[model samples]
Target: MRLYLTKAALLAAASLAAQPAFAQESDDLIVVTGAPAPIAIENLPAAAVVIDVDDARVRGDISLDQALADVPGLQVPRSGPIGQQTSIFSGGFESNHTLVLFDGVRIDDPSTPESVFDAGQDTLGDARSIEIVQGPLSALYGSGALGGVVNILPRRGGEGALNPRLEIAGGSFDTLTANAGADGTLDRFRYALNAEGYTSEGYDIVPERIATHDGEKDGADITTLTGVFDYALTDSLAVDLLLRQREARVDYDPGIFGNIAENPGSEIQSDTALWRLGASWALSDALSLRLSGGALETDRVSSDFGVAGDEYHGDRDFADFSATWSITPEWTLLLGAQNEDENIEAVSFGSPVTGEQEHWGAYIATQGVLGPLDVTAAIRQDDFDGFGEEFTWRAGAAYPIGEAARLYASYGTSYRAPSLFERFVPFYGNAALDPERAETWEIGGDARFALFGQTEGLELGALYRASEIEDLIGFAGFAYGNVDRAEIAYAEARIALRPTDWLTARASYANTDAVNAATGVALARRPEESWSATLAAERGAFSGQISWRQIGSRLDTTYDDFGFWAGTAEVESYDILRASAAWAVNDEVKLYIAADNVLDETYEPVNGFAGAPASLLVGIRVTP
Candidate 1:
C-alpha cells in the first residue's frame, strides 16, 4: 500500500511538471529565523517551512501543535486530548532538543527537568506566521537547537488605516471559544491587540483506569492576551515592544497504569508571561545595529484529590546585541553577543528546592552571493557558569540550475545544555551530566513550472540526519544518573505542489531508527515509519481541505505491578482522517465547519492512553 501511494504521488508530480511553461510573478516571502536579518526564502540554504495565519484558519486549527503536525520530519506526542501535556520531536530527538521562540524570545520553562516548552498552553489567534527550520542550528541560535528551531511571529500594525476581527466557535464535548483583535497605524505609532478565551468539558483519556468512577470527565479553561507597539522615530531608526500572557486550568485523569480508584481528582493551574523591548538603527547605508532584551516568567501548581500538591516558579531574562555590515554588493558580515539568566524554585511534597544558572555567548557569520551560487558560514562560542565553554559551526551552499530550479546542501552542529532541574533537584538530580551534542547534513532541490495552462509550484526534497549523545541522563535505582549512550538516524522525503491559484497539495514520509548503544534496545515512542498528506482548494467565496496522517508500530515500556521494573511492549499502528470547509457570506462575515477523526479510528499516540474520537465544530468570523 505504501509503495502504491508513493508511486501515485510521483506520477501526479511528473504530470504537473510536464505541462508548458507560463510567465508568473516570483514568490517574495521573507524569513527572519535563518540569519541575523530578514532574508528572502529563496536565499536560505536550510530546509524551512512557513505557515501563515490564513493556512490555519482554512484548516480549522486552533493550537500550534495541530498546525505543525503536517510538517515533514516532525512528530507531536500528546498525553491525552487538547489542553494536555504536549511535546514535539524532530529527527528522533527529545522535546528539549528543539528551540521554541515567541516573538524572537525563547520560551523554554526553567522549572522543567529538560526546559521543554508546552504548546498546549497557548492558542494561535494572535500569530501572523510560523517558521520551522529543520537541522542543527546551534551556530546561529545558542543551545537547545540540537534538533531545530520554531519561531512564532506575532501580527503587527501598519497594514491599513483600521482593521478589526472577531470570531466565535463551539464544538463537541461542550467546548466554546471566542477571540477578538484589531491592528492599525496612526502617525508615527502602530499598535496591535488581541484577546481570546476557551472552555471545554473534555472526555476521559484513560478510560480503563477511570471506568470504575461515575462518568468522570476532565475539563479545561484558558485565556490569553497579547499586544504589540511600534514607533518610528525616523526613517533610519525604530522602537518596538511586545507583551503576551496566558492563564490555564486543566483537569486530567490519573496515570494510565495506576490505580485511579484511589486518586479521585487531578488538576493543574498555570500562568505564563512574556515581554520584549527592541530597537534598530541604520548607522550607515552599509552598516546597521540592533539591540533587544526580553523576559519570560512561568508559575504552575498541580494537585491530586486536593492533596499532595506541588508548586513551581521560573523566571528567565535574555538580551541580544548585533551589528551587520555589507562589505560589498556580494558579501555581508554579522557579529552578535547574547546573555541569559535563569532562576527556578520548586516545592514538592513539602520539600523546597531552588537553583540559578547563567550563560554568555558570541558569534560571527558571513554570507556571499556570487553569480548563481550562494554560500554562508558561521561559528559560535558559549560559556556556562559551571560547564566551561563549547563551540559550534555551520556551512551551507546553494546553486540555481535555471530560471525555475535550484539545488541546496548544508552541514551544521548543535547542542543542548543540561537544565537547572536536572542538575540541582533534590533526589533525582545529576550534577555530573554533560551536554547533549548533535551533527546533521542534508541535500535537496526544487523546481517550478506550469500545469493545466496555469503557473504551478513544485518542490521535492530529501534529508538524512544522525545524532549521538555521551553521558545520557536517565532514571536508575530511583536516582538520575549518566547511565547510557544513545544514537539515532533519520531519513525523510517530501513533496509540495500548487497546481493553481486556489489549489495546494503536500505529502511527506519519514523513517527513524534510534537505540541505546549499550542495551541495543529501540528508543520508546520513536516510530519507524510515519506519513502525512493534505489537499486544499478554494474557489470564489468557498474553501475546503482534507488531511490524512498515519504512524507505524513501535516499541514501548510498561512498569510492573509495584511500578518498579520495566518491560517492553509493542504498540499498534493507527491512521486518522479530517476535513473542513468554509464559506464567505460577504466581505465582512464568514462561516466554517470542521470534522476531526472522521473515521472514528481508535488508537493511542502514547501507550495505554486513549485518543480522541470523532468530533465536529462550527464557527463564524467577522472582519472589517
Candidate 2:
C-alpha cells in the first residue's frame, strides 16, 4: 500500500507539471430526453445520468453495456460475450419495462419473447451522447417505460471543413475491428456517416460444468452503418434525414434442447433497418412546430443442426408531431401526439402466426420557474387498440440551496403494454394479459465544491427512489400472466473529485432491494449492492485510467447438471478490474492499449452462464 500510494503521488506530480499546457474541457451536457427541450443536467428534478461516447471510447468501452455497467440502479446481464443476448433490468423492473430510443426513434422489437431492445446487439461507435432517466417516465414517453428511459443521440454533422476518422485493429481471440466516420457541412446542407465491423473468435460462454456436450469455440460478428443529413430551405424551415442498418450473427451453445447436446451447431442471426425523415418550422418567436415519421424493420432467425428452427420478424411505422410554445421567457408548453402501427410474425415448426396492434397517444407538458423553484409537469393519454385506455402523469420540482447546491424531488406514473409475442405466441402466451403498471417517486440533491481551481471539480450527488408495480407479468402455470406485484427501492450515491489539475477520481454506489409483493421472492439479476470506482489522469500527450467494479450476490435460477431447467438459487458476488492507457502521437493520431477483467476473476453474470475472461487489445486511431 505504501509503494502504491508513493507511486501514485509521483505520477500525479509529473502529470500536473505538464497539465498547464493543456486546459480542462468545459462541460456542455444539455439533456433533451428528460424534457420537451434541452435543459442543463443540474436543473432536472429527476435523477439522470448523461454519458459522452468519446469518453467511453477512450476508456475502451465499445458496447452500450460496457459503458453503462457502472451506472447506479441499472443491471446489464449478458448471457455470453459479444453477439450474445443481453438484457437490462432497471430498478428491478422487467427488460421491456425500460424504453430505449435511438435518435429520437423507438427501436425495440415487438417479436422478441419479452419485446425489449437488445442492448448488446449494437456498438456505440457512432453514438454521440447517451441520456439515462431513472424512475417512471411513461407520462412523457407513453407506454413501455414503466422503469425508465434510455436515449442515444447519434453523431451530427458539424460546421466548417470535413472531419474523417478511421481505425483498424486485431487483438485477443483473433478479434478484428474496423471503424470509419466522416462529418462535414456544405452551405445549407450537412451530412455525417459512420460504419463499424467487428468479429471475434470467442471462447465458450457456457462452461463445461453446466453444459451437456463438449465446449466449442463460439464465433460472433456485427456490422453497422448510420447516416445523417440535414438541409435548410429557409430561415424558419429545415429538414433532416436519418438512416441505419445493422447485422449480427453469433454461435451459441443452446442447453439441452429435447435431450440434444448443448453445443450442436446452434447460431442466431439478426438484421435491422431503420430510417426517419423530419421537418421543423418556426412560425414565430413563441411557437415552433416539428414533425417526424419513421419506420423500423427487424428480423431474427435461430438455427441448429444446419436448419432454421424458428424465425421472428417485427416492423413499426410511426409519425409524430409536436408544437412548442414559449409563453414567456420563464415558461413553456409542449403539446405532442404520436401514431404508431406495429406487427409481429413468428414461424414455429414451420407454422406462421401473425399479430398486429395500433397505438395512439397525446401528451402535454409545462416547464417553468414557479417562484424560486424549477417545476415541470406532464400528462399523457394512450389508447391501445388491443387493450383499453391508459393515463399517466408526472410532476417534479427543484429548489435551489444557495449557488452550488439544489434539492429536487419527482413523482411519476408509468406503464408497459404486453408485446405481441407475449400475448399471442404458441402455448406460453396469454391473450388476456393486462398492461404492467408502476408508480415511482424520488428525492435527490447535488452540491459542487471547488478545491484548488476550476480544474479541480469536486461534485457530489445522492438520491433515493421508491417504486411499486402492479400486475407485473410473470410466467405462471406454463403460460405468461399478469399475476404478480412488486416493490423496488434503491439508494444511490456518486462522487467525482479532482484532487489535482491532472488527476480525477470518480465513484458510484447503489443498494437496491426488489422483491415480489405477493411471494416475497427476490427479482432475478437485480443485485442488492453494487459499486464502481475509477482513477484517471491526463497530461499533455498521455492519458491513462484504471477502473474497479463489483457486483453483489443475487438470486438467479440455476440449472441441472445436464443443463436442464431448475429453480432459483443464490449466486456469489464478484469483482472485476480494468485498465487502459493512451498516447497521442501527433495532432491527428493516437495509440492505445486496454485490458479487461485484468485479474481474470471467474464469475457468472446470469446464473450459470460464464462471464468473459481476461483480454487485451491495442489499437491506433487516425483523424484527418
Across residues 339-411, which tens digit of lDDT does each residue of candidate 1 receive? Answer: 8899999985577868888989988877878677777778889998777788998887777776666677778
> Over 4 Å off in model 2, which ranges?
1-40, 211-215, 258-261, 349-351, 452-457
Clash pairs of candidate 2? Answer: none
Residue 21 CA displacement from its true place in model 2, Å: 35
**Candidate 1, residue 396: lDDT:** 77
Off by over 4 Å in 1: 1-28, 31-40, 208-215, 255-264, 305-308, 370-372, 476-478, 497-501, 558-566
Give the range of the ten consecutive residues with the poorest summed lDDT in model 1: 1-10
Error of 1 at 427 (Å): 2.5
| Candidate 2 Cα RMSD (Å) | 7.5
Candidate maximizing TM-score:
2
Quality of model 1 by C-alpha lDDT = 0.73
What lDDT does the true structure give each of the candidates? 0.73, 0.77
